[model samples]
Target chain A: MSSPPRDAPGAGVLRAAFAVARKELGESFRDRQTLLYTFVLPLCMYPAMFWIMVQGVLVVQGQKQARDVTVGVVATAETAEAARGQLALDEEGRGRIEVVALDPETPRDADAIAELIEGEEADALLFLPDGRSEDDPAALFFDSTSSQSETARGRVVSALEGWTEELRAEAAEARELDPEVLEPILIQTRKINPSKDDGALVLSLLLPILLVVMCVLGAFFPAVDLTAGEKERQTAETTLLLPIPRLGLHLGKIFAVCATSMIAATLNLLALGLSAGHLLGQLAGLGDGAPKVELPLGALISIAPLAALFAFFVSAVLTGVASLAASFKEGQALLGPVQMLFMLPAMATNLPGMELTATTAWIPVVNVSLAFRGLLVGSASAGPLLLCAFSLTVAALFAIWFSVRLLSSEEVSLSSETISMTRILRILRPR
Target chain B: MTDPTNTSAIRAEGLAKTFHDPQRGVVEAVKGVDLDCRKGEIFGLLGPNGAGKTTTLRMLSTILAPTAGRALIDGVDVAEDPLEVRRRLGFLSGSTGLYPRLTGRETLRYFGRLHGLEGERLEAAIARAFDAFDLHAFGDGRCEALSTGQKQRVSIARAVLHDPPVLILDEPTTGLDIMASSDMIQFIESRREAGTCVLFSTHILSEAERLCDRIGIVYDGRMLAAGSLDELRAMTGKEWLEEIFRELVQRADAGEGAA
Candidate 1:
């Protein structure tokens, strides 16, 4: 038979990369483990993790909401009767001053008082010492270590002050004592930091950071497998030999990895969404509510493509470098460091006060993280987005070029010689 | 005696290849060899280990480029357009690989596509190869699961799936069982009858003597003799081709150049 028509060697070449992409997608779908790990597990894992975190926050908030505690009033009959009539008036809907009156003559015991704090039964103890008079103030004994106890201490002090004023007024009416002399000075304490009252300070930071983590974690396995795994299994040699273009193989694998990551990330986001109600209920004290966070539809759509691009760029660079490495073992060894480098920028977004910009947008790992954070906090700037997209495209192109060079390099293709310590020393030693 | 005007299926002119090691500098693996293999004939290239026979075959198959000179596969220069040369030829090395994960059928189909076969043609070709190689029993079996002989048969099946006009098989029967070897020998004879120019390389002299229409004695990268077995025997003044081969290679190693 004669040679093939020369007019369209280029057409076949163009389709080659797509063909490889298709094959990679098929292989990924074929593996049951890949599906479970990339898609199914992330879906279940993120919500479960979020729920646990929220549950912890909620338990603390619930204690904070209790506001006041019941304290034992151990005092004489005369003091007790006077304390009752003079007690601070409890208002409805105030969620305060829930006093469970204890026996006035009960002996003071540390263990019993400790049990009240530990069991969360009471907040404080009003200890009326023996032979206490109307002029003498009753000492409030409460655990400062307990947050509830501290709150209850404030309530007891205010209630006693009210009672002291009423006694002063009654004494003034009956025996001409001065109410002003009894209470001369009043100190007003106010909160200094207004931002603290806005609620859920960590929400803005944690959400963006979590989103970035989810994206990276989701894509990690598939990206490495698509490139390095092929080399390990020796399927790469057979793949390269195919009449399909090398670019097609690179693009195809990138798409597959990207798709896998996107699916995982999307499911993770959904899990977070479903658990949002519970998280809000738990953190209600921290903010007005769970900050009413939702991934904007536009942001979600943008994320899908962005994630795909990120996966492609990552896979291309890693695979390209791995292909050039000495052997399958060398490829895998090198991939870990490459992954770390990619993760560094994203991890940086988790730091307090770190912001994304156009200049830093070109920095690979950081850019993806920053972009993800911006999307999460509803402040994703267009400049940074465009910059990251450009940087990713450039990186992708570079990786493709590198891969092509690797493919062409006879030494890389034929020899699996790795550089060990011995080899390195051979280079270092004098001839 | 063959017609020169019909043109050689694989023609090598003054072919040379030198391998360079960073530590050892340059080693000349092949130097100044000329060969002409005719159509409808089996040309056996015989030499010991490190005799450069494999290198010669690799150059002809366009797997490796020669350092100097040229190899043509049916008139297409291997150096200028290797894919063209590859399209016309099928190559199988003794230790060439089959993907361990791929089934025998998958391997054949993949290679068939690589050689540019598609649609009905690709399927038909693969089916024919499966039938011809008697690989139906293990067609769906992964390459790693198959026995050594079965793997070799699959390799051959993949190599020849495109049914190229030229077949360059380098030590194709090296690790085969006696039965498999016999089957391969018979396959080559039949392919020759159907007009596929067969260049079969081996270290086994008796196999070469039995199979080749023309036998070339290669020593240290040079073809010492190229002719029918009888012609080679006549040139060395020996009764048997094996004796002639021994005498020529021995003489060349002893610093007596070819006559």
Candidate 2:
């Protein structure tokens, strides 16, 4: 077999870099488990996990709606009968309380009545006289800490409303006054909460954390494989022997990890979509009716840039840190801190009152988290979000430059010998 | 300065490297080494561990920069133009490995591309390597699955994929069985026949004796001697190569000049 002339070789830096990236992507997908981690897990696992969670919450809520609470009356038997009769008039069962009578001769001791509630004999105790005129209404008391007690109080209020209506009617007949004149004004209100409001709070809490965390996680394995894995396999020097620049080599590796990250995150987004159906199904139990839980399409589309930028940001960091280690296990250990670095900032976004402020927009991982959350909620301002993007770009550039510098130097890359601090300082200080 | 002609495939003069370890202060890894290997010849560097055999090869292959002095690869200065030096060179070591996730064929293609070979030419080059190394049967298998000998062949194939004029192999047979070692010797001889200079290090004395057109004995990061087998024996006044090697190491350890 004859060999070709050595005078010329095909393609240059960009092409070579891409070749390296292609090889990495191909190799990653070939291993079934790696592919699963990269694609399948995010697509299937999160949805199933979220479905189970939603089911659990719905069951607990359903039990609460059907619960019955006992109401203990501190008044005489006739007073309790009047309240029961008033409650019985309403057929909707809006009053979910069971009535129990007390002795009329007993002192109206609020403390003794409270004892019944404290001892768990009754959920709540109501205090009222056996008889009272329309102008002198009975007073009612119940424990606030217990949900049962709270429910009983609501039922007592409903019963009082009925007695008040009858007294007003009698007074209106005697005076020959219009019955509607008793109420001079009407009040109306609107609320935006999880039950009646859209799932804005959940969206705010989950979006950015998932975006940043999944982006980091997506880059994790690929970054490790390319850096420390190369060394452990004894292929680092061999790979570097090519004519391509160290920059090309690093860019190739960073590109591959970033691509994997985006792929993983996008799959994670799809998983979020699948699990969203179940999440919305639980909202229906609120009886306020929930529109389908649609992740703002704009937010989903915007993630492409944020996820890519984030992938670029963290992949460079992960690769550079991974390169510091000599083996896969050691790399994994070293990267524990790197993962924490990303996670802490992302988790900070979930804190209430934490917003995309001017200062926070320049805070790397934290900025991306805030900006991403804002984007999802359609509340992120353009100025701060762009600033956050710029900050991430700078960070990504620095990490890649650092990685390339480490890779380029013969003292470090060749024998896996790290430069001594004094040597590095000498280069830095340049005395 | 050992080059006798302009066609020297490798040349070196006073190559020096010193590493600073805090506890040990200055650790001189290589001290002013000078040597040369002519085209179509095999040069063997024989020494024990930490004797600078690897350090010297790394310098010549442009993997490490010299603290002082310089070397040339097939006429390209290693220090002044390291990329040019790397282009004309094929480097391998006992520690160097093939990608376990890639097949032998893919390994050849990747290195070929890195070396700037592509298209039909790259295919031809890979095919030539597969045929020359007799690696067809194991070409499709991932590198990790191949036997040690097969892996070694693929490693060598990848190294010379660009048809470099110079080959630098450090302890090429450090962990090979007898069969694999012989196969490596045959491959090295073939490269010499093809007019490519082969510089290698080995622990196997008989194989070195059989393969080297000339041998350089390095000890304590210094070149103690360089000559043909008969010439080495004559200089040391020893009957056997091992005796000469032992005498040289002892002399170097004793901090004495050549006898």
Candidate 3:
């Protein structure tokens, strides 16, 4: 009674907006369904999903490497004895490959060794002829696809090559000839791929795309639940009738949707990063020279801005469309296509040729995805980032504007346009 | 006439609303309706479903603007300054819901803040509401976990949390049990005694007959007749309000038939 009932003016609307936002936030966090989909589920499920996949790959690789492979030597008794001695010299190779000398009673030829390999008793074959001629065969045979067979073949060939070089040196010395004359040139290949940052190509393309997809997924339920959910709960009318301007109310709901989306996105980033980092550490232990790369800090940091922008654009668009929907089910019907529309660009950004560029900087969802990729790979420049940021910000603004328009319309906000029987029948039998 | 804005707690003059669809062209929902509710009086808008009762209530509450005319709540025009009108009014409907996750206290705090009450005053207001509504026992429970009667109580409490001068309720007790309905009726009666203007709509004839100081019978977006129970009985030459309602509807139908 001491003061006027209505607010003084402009500041009141803002205060009311914050009040609405606070309620929206408080209510959403308390909702069990919202909490599950937006926080708990993403946190627990993402790490588990990553764990299963990495474990599967590691198990397969480990089994293949640890499998024992038997190798058969096809040679005369003396030659077999010499070959067995040569293989025995390398103690570390013995654990992986079991070298067996064929009986002196059996023929030591390619066909005999082939039979042994074909019979599955031996994974590969090694043969050395009795004659000391270049024409006489000394061969290593194994299946190309089998890691065990390939390793066995490699061990036998290196041993034979070593014996041959030793014999050549002895013969050259006895004849007082220069061994350099026997070798005209030395050929070696320096491998560019045998060095530098591991998992760069795969993680660069993959982590960003996964993150973008997760961000979208994280925003989905909250955006749908807040706008359409409130209508279904019949709370929209009461909220709409409040003294606060409709834009203030709409913004409050939008912020709630965005907050849930960001939380889900951040949870996913952390879960994926930790699980993936652990997986990489485990994988590094398997090979001495293997490149050990972690899902980077910069990648997660880049996704932050991209996630916020993407979540903002997506949730705003959802709010606009959801405002048109009369119920939660109807919102799903409308938002499903919008979600697919967003998904295509997110997926496309992961393709080989979908790199960030001047032209791509203007495409709404694709630009963010590509820009996110560029940020992770260190290939994006400030100009493209600005361009991407500019376009998405505009799109977000447009969506907010459209949502405000929907909120302002009396017919749109007040009516619950349920699908009537007559309307349903008309759809069933259109004229 | 005296300025309706200056005197009435709630006022509407030739208030109307029309809906438009691409295929249907134009459909009038609330057509050129006029009414008034003064302080310390309860006005009942009696009508069946789809009879524009809700549409009229919506317009008065500032949820929907009148397409043809204007309304004022506590001297503020709804169409011109809906925010001002909403500030002075408390609106409740059968379909108005409580936030399922929030407790009874939180719901009151939420609406009170929206009405610009905060800090110590808001807290004190909530404490008063708790005692007034006897919401103390169940104030801590989440709304979703509460029973139907409790939910209704919380809903009504949310409407009056801001303590607006005018209360607009659309079928507020439509789904309530006998105990809950009696409780709501008692609450409305007390509000009238406290000098608050109460305007509500209902299809229950007995409720209109028992509670309203004056009743308006609405049909097909028009007020067929409006008066006290005795006045309606005298005008329609019927003893019962139900018979009066039947007679008024039949006469309107006959008029349409002749046309």
Q: Which candidate wins on DockQ?
A: 3
> TM-score: which is higher, 2 or 3?
2
Of the candidates numbered 1 and 3, which has the greater TM-score value?
A: 3
Error of 3 at B69 (Å): 2.4
Question: What residue pairs are clashing in model 1?
Answer: A16-A244, A16-A245, A17-A248, A17-A249, A21-A252, A199-A286, A200-A286, A345-A366
lDDT, candidate 1, residue A304? 58
**Model 1 Cα shift for residue A368 (angstroms):** 2.0
The lDDT of model 3 is 0.75
Which ranges in model 1 have alpha carbons more than 4 Å from their true place? A1-11, A27-241, A244-288, A293-297, A325-327, A419-431, B1-6, B20-23, B219-224, B238-245
TM-score of chain B of each: 0.94, 0.94, 0.94
* Model 2 DockQ (Cα-based): 0.48
Per-residue CA lDDT of model 2 for A69-102, tens digit only, reads 6766666667678766665454452436677776
> Which is the winner by lDDT between candidate 1 and candidate 3?
3
Tens-digit lDDT track of model 1 for A1-431: 44433332323654655555555665665555567766666677666777787778776656564555566666766665555554435644333665555676555678877886687666777767545457655667789887778877876787777766666797776766676665688678865534322222334454444555555555555554555555555454445444344455556665666666666667765666556645654656444423444434455566555666676666556555565455545666766776677666666767866667877788766776667657655567888798888887887677656655554444444445543444334433444
For DockQ, candidate 1 versus 2, the one ahead is 2
Q: Rank order by TM-score, top first?
A: 2, 3, 1
Which residues of candidate 2, in runs, are more than 4 Å off? A1-12, A31-34, A68-75, A79-120, A123-185, A190-202, A283-289, A409-431, B1-5, B22-25
